[model samples]
Target chain A: MSASPGVWLAAIFTLAIYSFLYGDNPVYKFSEHLFVGLGAAHMAVMGWESMFNRAWTPLYTKGEWWWSGAIIGGIMLLTRWFRPIQWISRIPLGFMMGVAAGLSARSAIDSQFWRQIQSTVTMKLNTTNNIVYVVIVVCTLAYFLFAFNEKSGLGQGIKGVGLVGQYMMMIAFGASLGSTIMARLSLVIGRLDFLFKTWLGVLK
Target chain B: MKILRSSVPIWLGVFGGSIVLLAMFIKIPVHVGLWSKWFLEWRVILASFALTLGAGNLLRIHANRIRMKREAWMYSYVTIVALIGYTVLGILFKRTHPVYSFIFDNAYSPLSATVFSINAFYISSACYRAFRARNGHAAVLLLSGVIVMLGSVGIGYAIWPGFNTMTQWIMNYPNSAAMRGMNIGAALGIIGVSLRVIFGLERGHLGGE
Candidate 1:
């Protein structure tokens, strides 16, 4: 495949970064610094655009005067650098902080707690798979509880169950690790594909 | 006497939080409740400033590095230039412009992918040492990992189709169960933390006066 100038530059940068696998070097450092700068710069540009489209347009064009409060508040955030007015920045900072807490709490409670309990409670235990799932979940949760004295008979039983839970966790974690390796390998494969097809013209 | 120090910020936080939380659950007539909608829009504006704080911090660090002439500080110049150059280009020419996309595609994309991909080598190295099954628990983990790996690849299926089924069973049952337990625990923690923030008990974000 014929490659463009941009593609050639991309290939060069990719190789420069890949050199880090062997050892730390100037090329890797250069690429790393450039990447950091680019990422931050992109975020700043996006923030500007967001302010324009989302904040500025509604306030000026639509005559949403109350938005001026937010604009003022957002500016106050900059006062964090100045000592006297730093307290004022907390007004906006607190506003955003409260909003975030509300949003996250609402979602977490709904999606994670309520929904999961619903699923667990509604399961049909007639099937072996369903039974095993419930048992494993119970045992896993038991592993986290340390209140029971291990020397007691009941505590020993719980410990035994928790040990089974531990084994199950290891298997699950192993699968997760396996999946991560596959993902990482896929990235390598993608780079190798580009090198061969786009840069070297070795493979079609 | 100490209203500003003690009460005002808490009231502000409560008021701001109530505005957002109420809007989500309560629906008001558009004509009368335009004010409620304004709070959401205000949030977006306020959020942008938070974005500025992050970039500003990064710039401050690099600028300080340059001023002090720290070792390899020459790289700081490259970072500053790239950051300012890209931000200016984006504002002037827009992100869709050829030069912007070219820089993004070439400089940013390859670097990101390469960084992530480099982890593959470390993981492989770590796996070689860690996967040794000296104990029973380690044996189970290694067995699961091997089965999953072999099952995922084509060569594994070529060798034994049962590898895939074994992997499917392990993931679907044990993995799902463990993950569910973790989710429940994490969600409870999130709820506790969120409540603390909403109730003004967590003043950590407010910093200091």
Candidate 2:
């Protein structure tokens, strides 16, 4: 047992959530729901503070009342619950999605498309590695060319290249999956350490 | 009504999206050459408020459950109480409030971490079942995986001095090439989707009448 109430709460919640591994029960459900409620409430609190600082502060201190338009638009999101006025919700959703799309698309084009092609073409060192990289990239890109029928001779060649590309991808994915296991294992160890060391004080 | 249902939203998206898109290219010194700066802030402001949507939905769902006396309605009541309680404490005392921080530090932290860490057990079980080399491709993949995993740890380095070099070569050349190809394709896909949304073709996001 821990003297600190915070540690007790932490340990209890940790055990309760882990209890789900054994089987679903009321304790796990309580912990799960409690998490959801608390998480959302926390977000709301943070959002309110942020809005006050970013939107309201400017309007109050800097005399920029136009900032209120963003707040009003944001409040329209709650109209999602209203049946007749639900269409209004789309207004804000439209704004959010559009802004997000624009931001991502611009960055994606420059970073993902242009920058990658740029780097691949500029491989001036390590001649063997460069050639291998160029070949792998071209072949892997051929994997996405599904517009042509693979029954033709040229298409078959492309398909073969794509097959090699798939193998390369599988190798990468295997390394990724292996690393993912290790990462999750670290999380488990951290939690177990908290349980043993922090909660129970049984481990150094 | 048709205009309100679809056309309005589409144009709104295009208008909002175009603001940022154009800002990226064209430099307008409006508002002391900082209109774009404020527009970016507006984006954050808008998104912050949208965060409330999840809480709103949760409230309605659990409220309905409690109203109907559904199974485990007591849990729903617990959820509502927790939500209201935390929101009030958080709002009045700010996030740094001792009670709010206590709940977050203790309840939310442990619960979320435990939830995520629980995936480890299932993932290891899955790896055991999935890592079998039933074919040439599978064998190659598994071999690469084993080499990389072994090379990453001290024990494998102790066992074989070649593991690190082998893993580095595989990761740098073949893996990098493959990932670059996927990234380019995915970026093109993103541009395509963005254009669709801007053009009002991707109205699935808008739901229906």
Candidate 3:
């Protein structure tokens, strides 16, 4: 039994990519260059497609010349190249900044401030699981609270909370690190599996 | 002084932020949602342009390296060559062309794999150094990491069926809660940073305006 040409090609490419684990070599170098070239080309095409779809067609079809502002703005963004004309880029930059600021301002209340406060205040501690969560949250929040002194008075309560938060944060960070490690290991394992099944044809 | 007076970003940031804030609470169809969407779209467009700015910076830095004959000049040459080679090939041969695809398939894919593979070694070293069981929670973290690592490999399954269960429990319960909390905090920080930019406190993007 044999695989198709496409399968072989995929296997070869996979091997070529994985070869980099051995160190900097010809296969890795070749693959690296190819990736950059293709990625850049893909991005350019996508940009053009976006501009045509989002900006140009709407204007031509609906007689909405106002959309040309976007085009002009985009072109202005390119002016960062020319020394004297670099200032022109600021036009697009400013427009973008204005729009982003405006949008974020509108959404911040719902997404950031209000929602966070609501979630923070609305936790139920009736169940054992909920009690544990409440404790973690309270401790963590207290750990971050810089308003009180840690040495005395109400500061003692704050200090206790801070200690719990510190421990919880440490544990959380370690777990996060462990998960990230596992993910990388899985990728390597997948590559090895591909080597065996696809390249060597030993598995299947 | 004249330049300072005509600062466009500051005006845009302040006025735009205020308008957006006002628009958020408003029910008007014309002024609220569309305005925010338009702004987001513009930001995306601008972000694409910023990528070019980043590339230009990369080129300048590398070009300067070549000119100065810096240490490991050969690596710099290689970097410059690789960058220029890809740019030219894509421009000349059309991206979808077999030659361009060959470069992407053979060159880029391999490099990406190679970079990711380096993470394997780094993780090993980092875990070796950092996975000390100094406290009770630290001990749990260490044990969970060991299980997850083993389960991720084929060896954990060979050792015991329970490794998978333990890893799942650790991830679902403690890991998810912690990750969610961190993610929420990050979101808030990001929102704050964006707000600062909107209010003209961060003029770094304005190129020192």
Kindly list the interface RMSD, in angstroms, of each predicted candidate in the order they appear. Answer: 2.1, 1.6, 4.1
lDDT by residue (B1-209, candidate 2, tens digit) is: 87876777778788767766667677654542255456567878887877877788889999999999998888987788888899899888888888777777888888888888999999888877668988877777788788888878888899998998988888898888989988888888898888777665667788743
Q: Each candidate's DockQ score against the native complex?
A: 0.65, 0.70, 0.35
Which stretches in model 3 have alpha-carbon errors above 4 Å? A1-41, A60-62, A97-123, A147-152, A200-203, B1-6, B16-24, B71-96, B134-140, B147-173, B180-184, B207-209
User: Candidate 1 chain A: worst 10 consecutive residues by lDDT?
Assistant: A98-107
Quantify all predictions' global Cα lDDT against the true fold: 0.81, 0.82, 0.64
Q: Candidate 3 lDDT, tens digit per residue, B1-209?
A: 43532476466656656666666676776766566556566566556556556556666776787789875444555555666666566556656778667656655564466457668767878887677777676676677678776666678888997887877766655555444455455556567777776667776777674
User: In model 1 chain B, which range of ten residues has the least summed lDDT?
Assistant: B28-37
DockQ-based ranking, best first?
2, 1, 3
Off by over 4 Å in 2: B28-36, B69-71
The numbered model that scores best in lDDT is 2
Error of 1 at A182 (Å): 1.7
Cα deviation in Å at residue B125, candidate 3? Answer: 3.1
Count of clashing pairs, candidate 1: 0
The candidate with the higher TM-score, 2 or 3, is 2
Per-model TM-score on C-alpha atoms: 0.89, 0.93, 0.77
Candidate 3, A67-153: lDDT as tens digits:
676777777778788887777777567656766666655465577556755765676767775566656655666665666766777
Best-matching candidate per TM-score: 2
Judged by DockQ cut-offs, the docking class of candidate 3 is acceptable
